[model samples]
Target: MFAQALRDILQPLPPKCDIPQDEQLQEAMNTLEVIVSLLLKEQFDTWRYEALDGILLTVAQRRDADTAFFGGDCILITDQTVSPIEVEVTLGGGGAGLVRVCCRVGEKQDGKLMRHSYDKEHRYRTLIWQERDPHHELEWMYFVERMYDENGR
Candidate 1:
């Protein structure tokens, strides 16, 4: 499922003239929904949330390269009384995709959110394009778990 969804996003669309930009955006958004859904179920399910705001996916053409990359963030609505937790995902462009997933699981303290001594980050590289990649799944799980721990949740 992960590989298929990633492939849908990574696959090149019909050239700009052939496909409308809005259509491409919709397609990417759909694929991103699938990706984030998978991550939520497989990685961050342990974190209880009353609701999840829609994932925000951003895709941009790389100025320095031919390939484009994607980045996204989702707010997990944990408790109505507190601020939502934010989880972000960044995907790099290439035949071998690289993903960075992290989460901020805390309320603002001293005008800073999760301003801690340790920087919890996870980086993973896919084995190949359009292939099942567990590297990213593991990285995402580790990132969320670490963030949850750091936040004393």
Candidate 2:
């Protein structure tokens, strides 16, 4: 039920729309971060944000997989996954432009469990936050849906 509701809310934009200006892009990322933080807090009282680079490289060696982290460049590493359905909340930048919040999917090479810079072009879904709506009605849904989908629970 939640998945269906979330999917309905995160419908992607039309293919030819213009990219948002820098200010708008910043606003979208901020809004996305806040929404994700709130929802995750509601779902898990222990929710927290760690740095993806640091966590992947060091801290995660002795940490739990359910830990949440801010993956720099507006990406949130929701440490929840199952093989091919790894999920991350990437907002703006990273060649993805500013209008949409991306829910990217990729498999770790050689079944390896390490973080290294790599291209993400395999598969992704996104939700365009409508700049016209200051209330941010639609932007919140993508986090919920993608979190659920990528976590695959």
Q: Which stretches of candidate 2 lie over 4 Å from their true place?
A: 1-15, 44-46, 49-143, 146-153
lDDT of each: 0.36, 0.29
Root-mean-square deviation of each candidate, in angstroms?
A: 14.0, 16.4
Structure candidate 1, residue pairs in collision: none
TM-score of 2: 0.28
TM-score for each predicted model, relative to the true structure: 0.32, 0.28
Model 2: lDDT of residue 38: 51
Model 2 lDDT per residue over 25-69, tens place: 334334444554555455544345521211111000101111111
lDDT score, residue 135, model 1?
A: 55
Report the number of the highest-TM-score candidate. 1
lDDT of 1 by residue, 99-145 (tens): 44444333445544321221122111111212434254321222342
RMSD of 1: 14.0
